[model samples]
Target: MQRNAFMLLMDEPRSTLDPIATAQVDELIDELRQNYLVAVVTHAMHQAARVSQKTAFLHLGNLVEYGETGTVFANPTDPRTESYITGRIG
Candidate 1:
């Protein structure tokens, strides 16, 4: 069957996969982004950097920052965001 989707919410879709499988899933998510708004919640910062066009960084149930993925990861405006992305915090 076929269906129409406006947005896709994926929470660690690659969690249990090995490197090869994770790469495959990342590729598929990238492809799917062409047609759907894909929101991924992942702890893997590298994976987030790869597949997301926009990113939202959260800490302790609070939103620290939200913006273009590159900007948030490369030059975050908030110290909390920076700390988390830089491995200062888990």
Candidate 2:
């Protein structure tokens, strides 16, 4: 069988995955990003930290911050970003 959705922008496909399998898909997305452009919508900050070299913070449909992952995580220019990273606020 094929590995994953390289570009799932068209056609209806059944999501026949259990919780464990779904998690695997997330991991695969992170790995596939090394060779392809991947856009992942996730709420887990740590997950973004693991998969992305760049992190973008979106609050209320507005782009609040965008930059290097390490720089943003370690020192965010936006107060919201800082709070999100430090687990103080989100």
* Worst 10-residue lDDT window, candidate 2: 7-16
Q: Write the per-residue lDDT of candidate 2 for residues 1-90, one digit (tens) a residue.
A: 246656422111115556576567667766676766666566666666766687788888999999998888888999988887778876
Q: After aligning candidate 1 to the native by TM-score, how far in Å is the CA of 35 from where it should be?
A: 1.2
Number of colliding residue pairs in each model:
0, 0
| Candidate 1, poorest ten consecutive residues by summed lDDT | 1-10
What TM-score does structure 2 among the candidates reach? Answer: 0.66
lDDT of 1 by residue, 1-90 (tens): 137878888999889899999999999998988988889999999999999989999888888899999999999999989989999988
Which residues of candidate 2, in runs, are more than 4 Å off?
1-27
Every model's TM-score: 0.91, 0.66
Off by over 4 Å in 1: none
